[model samples]
Target: MKLPYLPQDYSKKEHIIILSILLLFAFTAFLLTIISTTGSTSDYVPLTNIYLGTADITHINVTKVVPQIGPILAILGTALTAPNRTLDNIFDSLKTISETPALVPLMYLLSNAQNVSQSLISLTQLAPLAISGNPATDTKDLVEISGLLKVSSNESQTLNGLKNLVVPMLQSTNTSNKEDRTTELTLDLLADSKDPLTVAKSLTVLNNLTMEEKMKMIPIFTLFGVTKNITSLIGSLETIVSKGDAISPARSELMLTTLQTMLASNPNVTMAFGTISSLASGDDEKAAIGAIQTMLEDSNNVNTTLSSLSTLIKSNVTQAESSKTSLVALSSIIQNVNDQSKAVTTIAQLASNTDTATTTAQLSALTEMLKATEKGTETINILSQLQTSLNPNSTTFKYIPSLFTLLDASADPPVSFSSLVTLTAWAQQNPQTFIPIMGILSDALAVKMVSEDQLTEMTPTLLEYLRIPVYFQLSIFTLCKRNLEKDILECSASHAVQNLDFRQIIYDALSASEFAPYLNALNIGPNDLYLEGDLLNREHEYVPSIKAVLAMNILGIVFAFVVMINIGFLFWMKWSSKSYAWVIVIFLSSCTALFLGLSCTVLTVVLQVIKSGTYKDAFGVVFTTGVAYSAMMWCSFSLMVISSVVLLWVGITERHLRIPYLMKKNPATIEDLENSSTEADNAIQETKHEATPGQIIRHSTDNSSDFLKNDPDEKQDAVPDIQQTNTSDSS
Candidate 1:
């Protein structure tokens, strides 16, 4: 990677020299500024005056202040004379000069100097500082300027800073000279006050006051500054002492010592006393001080504790929104507890004594209830109070936490506050209904059997139904009972009925007595009723094997029917003529037997296994009829075998009995060959006179011989015979 290149400024040699000279001048001025800040009071102020354009050459000797004053005066004098001088403009030009720590004291000194007011007009232009300058500065100047500077030198820094703070405020406010006099008087009194730091802070507070507020405090400060009558003070103290209630001397002394010490440390407290006194009566001030003293003496960390609690409450807003009703009930329950501490101890015992698993479950239940109600604090308080009343080893106590957690989630206030209260008076009449009904509610809440909105909507109706002294839950259960008679396959087809979850609802209602008959009828027990798991997570519908078995049976019947048809056709087409037709018939018959037999076998095994077990709930009478069905299937198989054998025998018998008629027509047979032979005989008779040439010649020769033997004188006849023979031979 290439390095970044920096552009450099190139200066000519002459420019560099000029730059160096200018730098040298700046450095000299900076050194002079430092000297001017730290030197003697006269030396510092007069030198600052030069740069500030306030220097009067006639009054000050520059060389006396510093040997380099000539150069400084020369530069500053030229700059000062070049423009019309105004405090704002002069200050603007001098803004580049860095402020030094020593400037405060030098300015304080100049502001107090006599006859140099015009030169240092802005330094102490404030009424507060200007009025305090004479007497207050007299005391300081006597030590630092007129006499030894040691007496008040320790207090000078604080006093000077106070003066600096007041100057800007006094200058900024457009107040009349009368208001200025009053402000100056207030400052004069404050400067003379005991603690300078406290006085300075108080004076700052007073300096920031508006013209109206200053006018308000002037008369108060006037008495505070000039009130020096010992007799008057004695009378006022006497009046207070007489009017005030007496306390033990010990307490009085102790309180006085505490107040005195506090005054030294935080003199603002004394100002507070003065302010309160001015605003009210002395008695009121005493009462206010007592309150403050009591507050100081108290050690509770209420502020810190409340802050944390407030933060926790704010963080639980979302949770509270969901379970508003429950939280409200919990809060009331907590507040209404007679012995909160004892209850809390009992609840604690309940948790500690329970099994770890049970405890975890209870805690989870509590947490959910808290989320639902947004009443965590109230639930916690109730649980804490209930702790002392709970028996660790008691079974009832084991569910107490879970029960309370559930109750905390109740939506209806009437029911929540008094959980045992029913929707109707009938529950009061029959305690049994009440018992089961209450159990139902508890279970419903504990297991989340219903949603909050649902519980809210149905609480009254369900409560009434429960108290009606009837089997209300059976109504719901009957909706699911339609599947009781169905086999696994049938049940799966009708599985949508399970969506009602009547079983779970009955379980939640704690009224399973009504549903017991259905349970037994279906051959399912209470343990099979799922109370915890999700219904959707279960396979409530189809059994793949049962469906496959049903398909197989259907396919077998169809195949058997097709094979029987084919066999019948074969027997009909070639039964008597084709010998091998029996073979095809047997093959087809065997195939039909196999299909039927296999289907029956599968059905028998499956039905038997299902019937032998507790599958009545799933398969009902469908599988339970295995014995009868098996027998029927076996009979079917036998029938199929018998039919196939009969077909085979028929084919074989027909082939053997069938014979071709030869010599004479067999009356038993109706064949085309016999009819063809009869027709051939008739043809022979019709063509008997139609002889061939050889037969005709031979017949003529025989006839001619007989004529010659029978009549010798017939030589012409003989010749005719010969000539006929010759003509026949030629033809």
Candidate 2:
């Protein structure tokens, strides 16, 4: 049979060589089997004793059947040169491949590879499954686990196949979906490795407090908290490891939580308390706070640790009137040593909200620390948290109190105004559910030159966030969100400053110096209706007494308004310029309008741009926003077109719109005329003096008149006016 493609070089020589090799392999393999059956030789077997499920009788039968079908091996060579050999014998050849004892290891290798391929599909089904409400659901996806155990083949397959399957699964789970794919992969590996570390990591993941893991952990941890189930899991884990104190990494974390829980619920024995107190008592603050600091630093632990710290601090200390606060001063070493934002937030909330006497004292210590201390790790963390702590529903509502306190002009010996500036910006962004920050409101009304000058540290040109003029909301540009200090500044003023950084911005900026701290936290930006709240607050106001917005929520709303205006302005500019780059402008306008909703006048401009197509006409569209971003886009288009037209009329058209076909069709230059030289020559001859049948002219008046028309008027009489004659023969 002829084939579509054939190998050129292959010939009978190659076939003979292959046959010789195959015969040699088969003959040697047969000889080895004979010897192994005959004598008790130590080197009889190349592969380990990983025999398949069939007994030795089946192996003998497979061997007999292979020779009966041995002729099929001929097709393993080039099919064209050996056309008589065909895949019709593919089944028989497969039987030979199966029976070849020398190829046992390779056959095992491929079979294991095939299992890996099957695992790929199993993992596909497992991906979404792993993210199920509990780890159990993801864990039950046993297809991959079954593949890993390999009841069919054991010695040849390494743990490599199972080990790597979890990494991607772990990474894929990291999103709004809150999927914990890692836990599923880890659970599958338990059957293969049987290593305590593997089981421990899986257990710890199951017990994690994330929304995904919480359902699993909540039952376990709560059970641990209330009953003895956690103890059972712990005891089972201890028995598996057979080690008393050196538990696996996963189990250690669970144990820590268990310890914390036990401490809260059941007071520890005197000896145990003494041991912990000793650990906490180190004069070396680094050593004293390392463990607690690490836990507090994690975004996962921030809320938990903050609540714990607040409870701890309140229980241990009391404020006195006419006393200088010692909180920041006492904790400066701790704060300066750690870079945990949650810890910083925990400290800041407590430190900033102290009564009048303590506020002054604590404020001084914190201010001095921020100024002189090179360790801004804590400040960045705290600032980042304070930036996000603007949850309208928070019980303490730290943003309003801290900001208003900073804005309080009447407080004796004002604290560091610069540090508070950034903090105030954050509070403005996240308005509390209750209480208006009147102090910050008044400060907006009384903006001084010095305060504006202070904005030089962060790029004020980009952030110029407060331009929105909201009492609570602080307006900032997208550029200022480059760093923690600036981000906090931006986050603080979010109530007043409407533009929220998209996740893409954070994803891109994660590598940048400023916003790197935010990669691990959940700092969601609010947009239009921005609060789909039960109408938490409807009015916005700035209080002169405190120099801040009375209702920080209103400030956030105003910030959103200004953001709408900025978006509208940008779109309008792009539309007016008649730039093809309007695609990007379109995107910016969309995001802004979407954020602004139909409540801003910017939407009117945007809509007019879309409808009128003339940028000049967008001004008419400038109506109060009513949640219509599409309208805003049209308005922007109108403004852009109108502006472009005005610029053209004023002779400022650098980017001019030339008539499309006119340039292509019109002969504007001598080169163009020369291109139509035949037409030019024919026309020239036709206009010459007419030599009628009876008369001929040697000189032509038509040529002379045409030349005179083009000649200078001063030289018009240089040539005499010639009379036309058609007497060619006489001439």
Candidate 3:
């Protein structure tokens, strides 16, 4: 239906009131937009600056004055907008004030600035302005104003100020009017502010009110959309509870009670189960957990809580991943309850679900709960129950096999590790039950290796496969040493032999030739092996000698030493210069051949050892080709070959000696020698002419300065002196 319109034959006073209400509404809408968009009232300063044509303004304290104006305008608008002079229409108009979104920020502004006292006084004085001379309409307006005063009476100052204004107003009203006033105040408080502290304080006040008053407020809570957005209500309660020591125990209890009442009153509020679970499990807040526990213990609420949790755990994978922490917390809480059979059954169903998405979180939460629970008959009983729940079709079955299936299917390392840890702990408690699971473990390992090509990519998988046997063997040995009365070695060895057979599983799995490349990628050595002959009861046949390995290492060290000594000797004798490039080339080439031979021998020994089944079946023996040693040998060989080629090039060019037909030229004749001598003379003359004073000075400083002699034209003197000496010898 369309809203009632203003009468056309209106008085000037009525017209003024209508215009004022419209203007107030437009202004309130604009302010709400600004606060909602920017999330702060400080944004108002920009508009203020724009209107005033000033930019220097830093802050405008609208907190005190604006809140007072909103309620006054609301009362005035409601009182004037009533179609008839009746209490019902005026009350109806007043209810619309609670629906106004702008009142939330306005109420929050007053609450934050601690200006509730002043705002209440202003609203109280303006309450009379809403009187339209009708006794009933005036009485309803006074009751509303009284409710506002009561809701705002949270602080001592505000409460004291409310007494003078509220007592006289309430005395004039009857019981129903008092209830109506309480309802008005409750709605005004609950519906107007979304601030956690304000909501929490409102709940506190509601809790202190009489039972009738609280019951009256419940429907208002639902009608005003408070229960529809129950997550926010729960969130506000969590904010109060999270304050820890800052909040009193009484206040916390009131908050929890308020929550319980909301949950009980509205079944629709249960849709916030995810949020409730998160709050219960997200923090170790006693109040939150207590409230949840109370709900679970109640016969009426238990099913709802359990069903919500189960649905969350069984939700799609994305929800499951995000709910991991919540599930873990729920599991922990369930443990403390008297009968957790249903909860345990729910978690087991999640764990057994074929959907891999939810299994990761389910298994993690279940395993962590199992680990945290103390081991005893209680633990055994829980496991037994879980086994039946997990494998409902089988009569005489163990959960270990189901766990293996889940473990194999899961690619997450944490899930896999947790499963293994649970198994290990269970084995420690019940060794007999663990005995049958050993074969299951072996089968699982084999399946894992076959299905997963990059097992090494998972550190847990690699460690479980390669290192678990050694760790287990050592653990057994330690246990034997501690418990056995005599013959510790014999006792340990006897028991260890039985356990060491599991190593055969690993050996058999890795024996496939296709695994060689993967194994070689890992630095597996003799230490990682369990030699065949070293078994306690086996006959010694092949000892797997390392003499070849030793010989190769010795030869490599000797060659390296020889090369170093030869190079040092050449340098000391001054024979490694350009004239002796051939000598260096020979030395480097010989070293290269020796390194290459050593590298080949090492590789041959390693490959032969691997092929001989010694590397695979060797028990309690360390055998490796020494990956670092082999790499070093190859690198040394490469360096020597490179050096040889470089030195050969230097020797060929520096000495200017050509081999065979590559250099076919005659020796220098006398005329050719003379021409070279004349060219040298001309070069010297050019150098003398072009020399700077500094160049001459540097040349003169040298001890050998024959080229810079005082006589520039004294050329061919050495040649003439040589000719005279030859003539004298002939005479």
Candidate 4:
């Protein structure tokens, strides 16, 4: 039977195609209904609501029969698109679908298969069976399902589904609700599961929930004894740490963070403080350090937190002295603490205790603490005590190079200054031990001028310290020269000078009367200083010229003029006579202009490269091609190329057309010539009728003779032929 809109004359193929199109349109409409209804509950059309209700029922039935089809759908979706999928590809596909008018209706269908709320509800129901009392049989299934939940949580839709399924369960106080039962099963798995992998997976899933959801689960977790389970997990990690076995740092951090989240959310401060302090001296002291750092973040817990930390450190010096990781974590913790006096005193006590066996760890820990501590009277006092506490001849002095490295330009100005002053005193007192590090100190000073203005204050101290030894001055100058060469190649000339001003500062300082003995000893004078200034100033002159060259806008003006000329040429070609010659002229001019524009663009780029390479030395001049000029050249060349293509197309397609008015002939002259030819033909016809047939032949012969007489050689041949015809007639 034919459809109502289709004609009766339609063939079977036509009918099939029309029906298929109709089906696609209907499907797209249904997809729109689903998306429109799902996006808002209040705006749902009655028909759309019925449609969605039917879809959700079908979805629920399929999920029940398939058992965990949500995860199956997620895996299938990933597998189908995972081969070469990238963020770029996904964005491009979405962009194309949105931009195309034909595909806009189908855009909502892309995520239709991923609407897995019903499937998630089904999976939620199955959680108890997977988390049954039998670990051997259920652990694998529980881990797999939990992992699936974790992976699916990255999608907003799946995450919403999870929130809906799990949040209500955590909020529900009823013991008989299935969702509440599911929550209980999950918490039991966390508390009683022997496999660390199972516990870690469960914690990760919980961590992936929103903060509100976590807050809701905290009390439930506490009531289920999950907090103790987490603490025990931390203990296990600490055991693994003490045994020197490689444990996942992520797992350890997760355990501690989970415990912190639980306790911090709890209103009981005594329990939180007691729990934190208990873990502070455990084998996993890093966990306690993290917990304390979290507590310190809240201003209410700062005093209690610092008190606990101070107590732990004072009681466990041996532990703090041996663990480098714990030391670094502690240093980071106290870096931002408001009250540093307690932390400093406690850490200084650890630094003051030196033993042959633990000297290295203690020195490392003290250095980290000093680095983290703000530079002030407290730091100075700490350094003075360390100066006396550390043995002058101990092997711990091996870290002097590291200590000297703290003068780096990136370091805090106050810290670098303090370090420099302290090291200078040490050098003055013990030249033998600190002498070897003077070269390192000079190298760092020469590079320090490149930092921000705060570091410039160290210039006088650095210069005074280096002036004590002539070789130190030479080492600094040499380093400054090397750095000048490297920095000049990487920056503009002015920037390079500003960065390498340390050399100039040293030169100016040495030229003073206070350093006259040192300068005279080195045979340096005003001429040396003037020569250095001249070398630095010479590169500044090149900067203005380079800027002038780059600032030239002549290329854009030329391109504009060329575009205007091409526009006029286009009009002239169109309105004037059409011919092969005109076409050739247009094509050649366009092609020539195209190549010339292209050549200019390439030449400008080459000039930029040559200039950049030529001045990439002590001059430090970097040349860049003008982007606007380059764009203009390319655009002009592209327009010419298009013109040339069009000219060629016109020439080929209209090759058969006649070239009228080749040079200067007009329509009137052509009309006059046509009339004359017609009159001449009439004259020949009249001659043919009025005279004998021979007369007609004679007239034709006369006309042929006149045509041949236009050429010299043809005229001679025609005369002989006429004479021969006359002779034959006489015979």
Q: 1 or 2: which has the higher lDDT?
A: 1
Residue 559 CA displacement from its true place in model 3, Å: 3.5
Regions of model 3 farther than 4 Å from truth: 1-549, 565-574, 577-581, 611-627, 656-682, 693-731
The lDDT of each candidate is 0.31, 0.27, 0.32, 0.32
**TM-score, predicted candidate 4 vs. hidden true structure:** 0.18
lDDT of 2 by residue, 226-300 (tens): 222222332322232223223333433443454465456654334333444454323332232333333333324
lDDT of 1 by residue, 1-731 (tens): 11011011212343234324433332332233233222222222232122100101112222222112222222223233333533234334323111322222222222222222121222212212212324332122111211111122322322222223233323423343322222233223322333323332332332333444333323222221232332232233233233234333343344445555555566555454454345433563465344333332231332332232223223332123322332232223223344333322332233223123322333333333333333233333333333323333422233222222322332222222121211112223433323432322222223312322333343233223222111211110021111112211111112211133323433433333332322232234434543332221232421343444345444445545555445444433224234455566567556655655775565455435433432323211122232323444455555556656766655443312222111013322222323433554555556666866566321112212332344243222000122233234345
- Looking at model 1, report the run of 10 residues with the lowest lDDT sum: 1-10
By lDDT, is 2 or 4 better?
4
Q: What's each prediction's TM-score?
A: 0.25, 0.14, 0.21, 0.18
Q: List the candidates ranked by lDDT, beginning with the highest.
A: 4, 3, 1, 2
| Candidate 2 wrong stretches, greater than 4 Å | 1-106, 110-731
Q: After TM-score superposition, what is the CA distance of residue 112 in candidate 4 from its true location, in Å? A: 73
Please give the range of 10 consecutive residues that has the lowest summed lDDT in model 4. Answer: 51-60
Per-residue alpha-carbon lDDT of candidate 4 for residues 1-731, written as tens digits (9 for 90 to 100):
10011112323353234324433332332233233222212222331121100000101111222222222223222322344533344334333323333122121111122323332232223223322344443233222223333333132332233223322322333333332222232222222323322232323333234433333322222211222233332333233334322324444444445555655578555566566556544455554444444444442443343433343333332132233343333334234334334333333333222221223322232233323333322432323333332332433223232222221221132322222333333333444433322222222223312221222332223333333111111110011110211111111112211222323433444454243433443344434433233324444443343333222223333433443343344333233224545464455535444444544444454444434432432222223343333444445455445545655554443312222321123333333333444565777678777786544254333423332233323221101122233334345
**What are the clash counts of all predictions, listed in order?**
20, 92, 7, 0
True-structure RMSD for candidate 1:
49.1
- What TM value does model 3 have? 0.21
